[model samples]
Target chain A: MSVKQQELEKSWQQYKTQQRKKNLYYAFLTVLSVVVFLAIWEAVVRFQLVNVRHLPAPTVIFQTFIEKLHSTVPDGNTLGQNVIASLQVSLTGFFFAVLIGVPLGLLMGWFEPFDSFVRPLFELLRPVPPIAWIPVVVVFLGIGLKAKATIIFLTVFVSCVINSYAGIKLTSRTHINLMKTFGAGTWETFFKVGVPSAMPMVFTGLRVSIGSAWSTLVAAEMLAAKAGLGYMLQVGRGVGDARIVVLAMVTIAALGATLSALLNTLEAHTLKWKEMR
Target chain B: MENIAEKNIDTRPIKVEVKNLTKSFGDLLVLDNLNFNIRQNEFVCVVGPTGCGKTTFLNCLTRILEPTSGDLLINGESADPKKHNLSFVFQEPSIFPWATVEKNIACGLEVKRVPKDEIERRVDRILDLMGLRDVRKAYPKDLSVSTAQRVIIGRSFAMQPDLLLMDEPYGQMDIKMRYYLEDEVIRLWKELGSTVVFITHNIEEAVYLAERVLILSNKPAGIKEEVIIDLPHPRDITDPKFIEYRNYITDQIKWW
Candidate 1:
């Protein structure tokens, strides 16, 4: 090969090696954080910072978690069944939240009159927490999937709407002006500029709302849940099985993290141009 | 297109007639009775001290800001694009961050309900002309200031508007890039021959680009003088006549 070609190949190899080293460095930092977190958790439980009766050790929790996963009750429902039930309620609520929130957000962002009109109403309802709506939701929908989902929906809706609105509004003034210069009518500009610009915010809201939905699942299930991780925790509390309660709590956290991570990946792929995490 | 030719072509020579165009922000007046006539196809550059209502004038032309009180005319009547197309190239590279360079350029076309294929074709041509063909699919974040500004100008030029208003579109660019772009804009003006009203604080830019440089006085701004450029196309900036005019405008502006 020519000297220039050989030099180019060598440089490219060096660049790739540097990139690999950077990736490895970041991976080590991430793993180190997890290890530190686990150590603190183990130390806290071992030192009896919280009563072992109420909060089991990490090892005990993991063992109990395995037992819960494998052990079947008389009804043949395993820990996974409970987790799936909780996930269903949260996912259902999240879907409804997005369905309702995105359009409302788009409306609020696109038209000034609507924004001024609807903004007050949303702000008024927003500060009222999702758990606060349990009674109202229970009264309206009764003790069923709908009621639980409604509680989760309320949890997710507020943030989703606010984020989506901010996303749309945050679109650069220059972009809006560019549309105006091109002879775009208001509606055309909304779809052409406002919607796409707000998409990143929409996803952000979705991620936040999904976590809220998952967190609210326990509270929602308290109303009329026959089977869910929240119900499992409630049952475990009744029998005073701290391990079961801890396991249930861990499962909730895991599910929330897992789903959020998945949604984050999806968001990254969808809004690849946005360069946002 | 020659300035005289442009003037004659605009049988209705007064495309924009600003009469007592006064603007104020509560107490301070930014523009005061700014009277001027811009003929169709005439490249008129307005140069003034910083914050001397150059942008305000363009905004007023675009209706982004409501003039406090003025009779602003376009094609002898109200400033409405239905009567005539109005386009603006802002100082900032206003390419939409979420959009590809092609999509940003097609924004105006999309609004006009032009056919998809036609939009694509025009966008391709404009991108190629602006030397943005390689980066057409790239987002604004990936592009340099010059490329981004070029995209902005390309977007405006694609509209094929009757009146093109530019607000220091090359202000963010380096001297070399600015000159190249200025030349490119001149080439575009000659090729498409659109009526342009350009705003700048730079005297050299005003002298370099416009057939007539309209000078505005400091705040509560109004036209102080109008210097007509008699130089031919691709005029030498280093020429004695160009330097003399630049110096003359500089002196007038320094005291204003």
Candidate 2:
């Protein structure tokens, strides 16, 4: 029986290896397809199928990205500086939203009084887009870092609050009962069982909120701003610098994808125990 | 019926007493004016039809559910779980999935704040007893159903409670594993001299493990009969007395 068990384990390992290889093959094809699409865009631009003034080739955008890296503007800022600026503002807003949203969501999920009283207010405010709040924010705070941060914060806050509450609500009923049987008091059960169980869902909310907060950067930057990737894109559009605009768009996509991947890793690490289940 | 038995048993040193224990949820009554007496170190098996309040009796004993109107006494006083060493092994596997077999077995000790060295000693002994030494570090999800059930049993037995409550704990196991675990429970109970309240729908199981068997009626459950088994430890399943009692209880349960 032991020998048979070893053989079965070996065969399972081999099966997993084959599955991984197949997945990698598919992933390679996906990358190849993306490359092919980019090549077509380059071919169209090189052959002057579309005016260079309107749409730059991949090579033009790549050069623009490199040039912006080396060239500092009047305020001692380069393209990298602009990217960092946008990230700082956006992340600041996102963090504030997380700080406020998580507790509010927990209260809404765990307590009937808060759910009844505060949830309605949140629902009423949630439907209004974050960008729509920009006019009022600008009127109060003006076009500065604070105004941009406020917009991003509001954008992420609604989604985070909704997701966090959902996460808490989705906690397993069995877990709570088990704790109760163990003689755990109400507060102890909430901390030991409810919070840990809801963590995965809360992380999901954070992921969605982070994505939305990043998305609002470009919109926030479209308004009056001195230095940010969004401001750079705005400047490029003003001067008809299609190469710079393309570079900004590519940077935004890359940043969004990278941040999302990082959050996925964090979620996986925090939920390692769930993997066994 | 249990109430009749309750009246017959002298109450001088009763460990637990149930008086007019009636329970109802909404319009449905599950337990009706039930009464029973459990002495210290006695092993009692409650056999009943589905939804016949066997589980409800155990719940009331543990104070998990409030009795609609009843008095539950432990040691001639009101039963308070916090003050008593009482533990329950649920019908399904209730081993904490978050903890390994060893850690799960040690949970009550940890909750009760037993010394570290003592916990380690007792955990090792229980793991050995359950034949789970090899899977000490294995989580519940990684173990087979039989192995997981052992973890639950081992955990409760580790607590060495004054009264151990088991609710159809071996219902999910195969025959061999079930008998083995039942014997293991008997061994532990004998060693600790703890009172036990075991609930099962299986008539054979009640006869095999219980000192006294209490049969309950179907929905709107009332105790139907009680029988005392005088057989010695490691009872012969085919013994004439065993077969006689088994048949009599089977008839009572089936007809009622």
Candidate 3:
């Protein structure tokens, strides 16, 4: 290569290396903070700074985590069984919420007649918390997966509809006009122009909803479940074992985080056409 | 240049007939009884004062706005997208941010339900013409303003619309880019032979690109004068005759 061309290539390589180093530094900071926090927690418990009865040492929590995998001593079911049960209900509820809520929200945003019919009842439900349905849920679905899933679905469904509605409502007027100039019909424009424009916000809603699915799943199980992380937490409390409670809380957090990370990957892939700026 | 006077006698069929068109926003009358006729394959540029209802007139012609009174007929029938293929490239930004350059260019054809093969064929031709082949898969956010405008123009011409309305499509560009894009437009108009109504406040842009220049008066606007630009293709802006027409139109806009 010519000297100038080689210099330009070398500079570009340097810039890329700088960016890589910056990303590595940030990742290191994240791991360091977590390690420091865990070390502090272990030290506090070992020195009896906090009561071992309340805040168990990290090693004690790890030991309980290992035992819960095989034994069902304190709680009625093992950790593996509880996790599977929770996944079944939450995923079923979340899947249906996405299928129904996204289209309903898009339709409501574009069609005035449909919005007029569905919005008032939706508004009424929006103000009521999803937990409020538990009493009615117990009465009808009778403390089964249906009841827990229903609770998770209601909590997630509202945000999905709200975000999707607002996303479509904010579809640019210029885009609609451009489509009109092309001879597009109303429904055609909605699918072509409106839906794609709404996606970034639609994804924002989905991330928020998935988080809701997990939090609401936990709350529902705490009250009425026989075999989930939240149920184990409740039973641990009833029998006074802090290790089991900590294990369940940690598992709930880890699973919630993993699901959200998976969704982040999906968002990046689907919105590849999106403006990074 | 004088041959254009002889060329004036040539009869081309009328493509756009604006009949006593007027538009009002409640008490505000923006377009007042404007009337004009544009021949088939004509490149007409309209120069008007800022906010002198240039956009309003174009919107009314496209029926994007309900004209307060009178009719806009294309090929002697009411202007309708279904009846006559129509396209607009306004001052607003181009391309759906979520769509690639190729997809954005193909959108008008897709809306017209053009067959898959034909859409690809036409889009390929436009990508070459508009110099967008390199960035066909790139999103608008990755492009410069000039390239994005070309993508918009490419999309408009891909449909081969019977009438194309462009309202300052290159308004945001710098002078060199604007001139370059204007020449590109002139070349495209010749190759495609679609009737174009190009609205701009830039008088020299009108001189550069138009076969006919229609100057509009200030708000409560009407067509004030019609000047035929008899200059030849690749006309130099520094040419004396070019300056004369530009100055004359500038004077009319200033006076009116």
For each candidate, the DockQ is 0.51, 0.31, 0.73
Summing lDDT over every window of 10 consecutive residues in candidate 3 chain B, give the lowest-scoring window: B1-10
lDDT (tens digit, per residue) of candidate 3 on A99-218: 999989999999999999999999999999999998998899999888888989898899999999999999999999888878789999999999998898899999999998998887
Among all candidates shown, the one with the greatest DockQ: 3
State the TM-score of the second chain for every model: 0.90, 0.91, 0.96
Cα-based lDDT for every prediction: 0.83, 0.83, 0.90
Candidate 1 Cα misplacement greater than 4 A, ranges: A1-17, A35-63, A74-76, A275-277, B1-30, B33-35, B68-77
Give the i-RMS of model 2 in Å.
2.5
Ordered list by DockQ, greatest first = 3, 1, 2
| Residues B111-139 of candidate 1: C-alpha lDDT, one tens digit per residue | 77779999888888888788888898898
Q: Give the TM-scores of the predictions, in the order they appear.
A: 0.88, 0.86, 0.95
Error of model 2, residue A202, in angstroms: 1.6
Distance from true position, residue A132, model 1, in Å?
A: 2.1
Q: Candidate 2, A190: how far from true, in Å?
A: 0.9
The alpha-carbon RMSD values of the candidates against the true structure, listed in the order shown, are 3.8, 3.9, 2.1
lDDT of 2 by residue, B112-227 (tens): 66899999999998888889999998767678888888888888888887678899998878899988988988998887677899999998888999989988988788888778
lDDT of 3 at B130: 93
Pairs that collide, model 2: none
lDDT, residue A134, model 1: 87
Docking quality level of the chain pair in candidate 2: acceptable
